[model samples]
Target: MRLTDMAPGMRLAKDVYDPNGNVLMRSGTVVTERLVKALRSWGIDEVTIEADAEDAASAMLDPKTAAEIRALLDQQFSLSNRDHPVIQALYGLCLERALGNR
Candidate 1:
């Protein structure tokens, strides 16, 4: 798939292959400019980008909805921490749940 084939908000994945068509990039490597160029040159614009398929397959969730869910979960689960990391994680969880990603 070429970059042109990619839709708005679509995630991307790349596979770096040697001359033998062997996979070079190990698992979990995110896309970068160099990688995109290489893939485009090869006429392969889209590879299987790793998304939280679990999340993507579920409903689409907005940030506002995610926040509301987070607040409710925090209250219900008794997650009292207000620190950045904790809050962020909780926020992410809430987003996932709201999005049906979890």
Candidate 2:
């Protein structure tokens, strides 16, 4: 998963390593915002993580379809406070629905 996808409470599925091959985190470490910040500082871009069923399903969403759905959602939510946490979460739920329907 990329840094953009990482979230607190997600569990690592494998060890994370630095460029020099130093282990950063062992498997099963619960992700935290601070840890994500540290990884960004270390220039780590991606790490494998255990996926829940919803995540697994979302991973199967086609890129083109997902983009299209997001575009549609953006238009639908154009008037809302997109920066608000509630708005962002609602957007996520809508995107999930849009993709899952296909």
Candidate 3:
């Protein structure tokens, strides 16, 4: 969830950690206005929130969409050696950007 869209009383779906690896807020913590402000101050821009079964299902990529995304990624990286670590990382970034936009 976007930090700006989050409201008071929403429960976190995952734990939030600081730059130093300390847990800032545990999973299942109920959000508060103060906590939101603190998160913003701490440079947190987004977070996962608990969702219903339907929401979780809808969030997933269907097989067709997954295949399309995979094909597109493959075409984009066709000229690069898939075994190279840097190319692999770039492909992952491309995949994330494509999925996020969709």
Q: Whose lDDT is greatest here?
A: 2
List, residue by residue over 1-102, the lDDT tens digit for candidate 3: 667757777788789998899899999999899999999999888776665421333347675786698798899888999999688656755665565566
| Each prediction's TM-score versus the true structure | 0.34, 0.53, 0.51
Ranking by lDDT: 2, 3, 1
Which runs in model 2 stand beyond 4 Å of their true positions? 53-102
For TM-score, the strongest prediction is 2
- How do all the candidates rank in terms of TM-score, highest first? 2, 3, 1
- Give the per-residue Cα lDDT of candidate 1 at 65: 66
| TM-score attained by model 1 | 0.34
Score each candidate by Cα lDDT.
Answer: 0.53, 0.78, 0.74
**Model 2 backbone overlap count:** 0
Model 3 compared with the native: what TM-score?
0.51
lDDT of 2 by residue, 1-20 (tens): 66676668888877999989
- Which of candidates 2 and 3 is the stronger one according to TM-score? 2
| CA lDDT, candidate 3, residue 42 | 94
